[model samples]
Target: MNRSSYPYVKTPPIFRCLIKKQQQATEELTYKPRRRRRRKVNNSDFYWWGFPIGTGGYVIIRFLLTIDWDFGSFIIFMGAVAIALISGYLLIRSYYRDFKSEPPPEYIVNKEIRKKAIDAKNKIRKRYLSRPLKDKVKKLLKGKVRTLEPLTPSATVGVSEKQFLAVLQKYFGQRVNFPNGVFSIIGTTFEYTPDIVYQDSYTGLTIDIEIDEPYAGKSKEPHHCNDNDKDRNRDDFFLKRNWVVVRFAEEQVVKYPVACAYYLSKVIYQLSGIRYEVPAEKLPSIPTWDSEESTSMARLLHRETYLKEHGLWQIRIS
Candidate 1:
């Protein structure tokens, strides 16, 4: 058959050669080994350098020392090294002893510094003390004083509470019963006692004072219910007997003592028809908490109960 007459044609030599080359390349790739990744050396291995150097150095020194015939120059060198090591060790030991035996540098310096500091403080104190009597009185009486006292159930009344009672005695003067000459409220019936009580000689007015601390935000339901309930029961008893109650928080005594005192003074005046003005500058601003009014009422009721129960209302204070 004539090739020209057929539609299909034979492949060219170049095309055949290309096909063979492609097959050979694919076969070569299939048999090739995979490349492995190398692991990195860690920097922490640097610490091992000390062990090798120390062991090798010790071994070399021991070997040299064991030689039967030592060169004179080598002996001199070894002796010098030995003397140097011994001297270094002694110096280190002496430094340690000095550090351990002597007082620290800070302590020595602080002692000297404290002496000068005390001298300066004394001079300032003397200057204030040398001021006029009226000025001195004002300073002593000025800002609210807070006596830091523990609030443990068994702890005694604090210095500030004592001072507050003293102030009340000074102002009221013979109008209240204070068996020890210092105003104090006492009752034999209850395990706990009120802080102070006062009775008017003419009108039969009774007033009770309680110095309280911050509420500390104890919840009313369970934690503080016992103390609160006791107060309520006491107040109710006083109300039944027609006595006035007054309560003062510790913050009121410390931050706004004059205001607290003024309010008490007002209550006294209303009861006894006696009048006094509380210095406006010293009065503390009224507290903004929701419990202030309730606290005031509770204090009044508690005081009334103690006075009525103890027969203090019968005391005539003219």
Candidate 2:
């Protein structure tokens, strides 16, 4: 038998069934359901353009019909314009109500965003509140501690000292060196600590500012012999050391800071070779004893004696 004459083989029944099932699956996949498209709603198209144009048309028609070419016509035109504006506003409101996309549901803010908002609010609050607090701090600091009496008036030494330090920091800035207490002065390590020292950059002069309060303590010993001797010795030590001491009493500084400042400025000017004049109003008044009844009687008696010698005593006495 020739090879060409051999019978052609047919596909198996199982293979034919598999091929039919695949064709059916492909036809089912090709048949897709169409997706419904969302309608596009534009806010400006509906409200800004459409409503205004429609209302404007209505207003123009009404104006042409009612116009009389007089003052009344002008008034009527204005009225129509006003009515059109009101209608346009209502139309815009209605369009927004009917066509506006629903606002997304209210969202709980994230922790970080909420925290940032809180921080911003706190910062604003602090900015306002800090000014008054700073002013209060400045006033408190400007108050002189040395002026306070230990027992007579209520002692505000602690408060005054803190305030004084704050003022010093504010005036001089942070780089200034301040001694901790009186003990720093007496320490043995050759440490140079002045109460209030300012070195002039130009003149190379160091100013040592000292404020003295009246020591009200009563010693059992005599004044000229005991504690007074120690004080005099201290004054001598400072003087011998060539220290320029600017001493002001508690009363002088507390009652008259301007006077204190004037004196201080004068000293600085003199040392620095900078010419300055303190105002007359800023100058401290010379202290004088007020005359009491006891002193007045003594003065009268002395005056009478002088007048009698001049033979003018009787006229004055009468």
Candidate 3:
């Protein structure tokens, strides 16, 4: 307990020296703040200094080397001037080439005019959306009259079925069913209504035509699946009742209306057991005011020409 009473154990001098050296080494290795590297400056001053200085030095050296205005000095000066002139010419030529390559302002003006015409046509079509029977039935019942969204005709021929119907009408006339007609397949508990139905008055033959949208083939969506199943059931029900069901893809109807009508006419003739000939010109073209299916006079001439050259359009639909 008294001061200096306990004896202390001392380490060897070599070990003590080694431990001190280790401590010094550790201190030397300790982390220090890193100095940031200076970034290279991209200054325009260097460019300005180099270009004028280089050019002036070259001109001065050339002048000093030439004692008098000789042919060599004249040749060098003229060469430089020639290069500058050539470069300027090339630049101007490139600019003019680019300017000329662009379409004229009139092209843009014409495109805008065509777009306006299409919009006007669509607006006029909206006036023809009256569903006469549906409206009449609603009025007679005096019940809650329901209004459905109008099927707006597409701007393009390949996107609307109305054009296809117009084509069919041009050839078959009154035989083609359109607009207000709907085929009802009556069941004991329910009923099925399809889009279009055609019945031949002479032969007492009925054909049910159904045009389906492009997305109808996709089986992934829930509503589409349900609709497909319902359609299959309806078709089966009709087939059992001895009804002839004809289905057409909407795209086929839109894109190839002429070919589609020809096929349909052939099939109708076969099913009805009646034979008839339809002139190519008489078949309607899509975009109906196509001069009234592209004009009666144009179509007649077209038919005459087609007949003269191609002989006849014929197909066997079995």
Q: Better model by TM-score, 2 or 3?
A: 3
- Expressed as tens digits, the lDDT of each residue in 211-246 for candidate 2 is 433321122112111223543344344444433445
**TM-score of each prediction:** 0.33, 0.29, 0.33
Question: By descending TM-score, how would the candidates be arranged?
Answer: 1, 3, 2
| Model 1 C-alpha lDDT per residue in residues 280-318, reported as the tens digit of each score | 434433332235544553445533343345443344211
lDDT of prediction 2: 0.41
140 Cα displacement, candidate 1 (Å): 41
TM-score, structure 2 vs. true:
0.29
Model 3: lDDT equals: 0.45
Query: How much lDDT does each candidate structure score?
Result: 0.45, 0.41, 0.45
- Best-to-worst ranking by lDDT: 1, 3, 2
Over the stretch 146-218, how does candidate 3's per-residue lDDT look in tens digits? 1112343222222234556677778777666542422343455343554454555444344556654423112
lDDT score for residue 40 of model 3 = 42
lDDT of model number 1: 0.45
Residue 166 accuracy (lDDT) in model 3 = 75
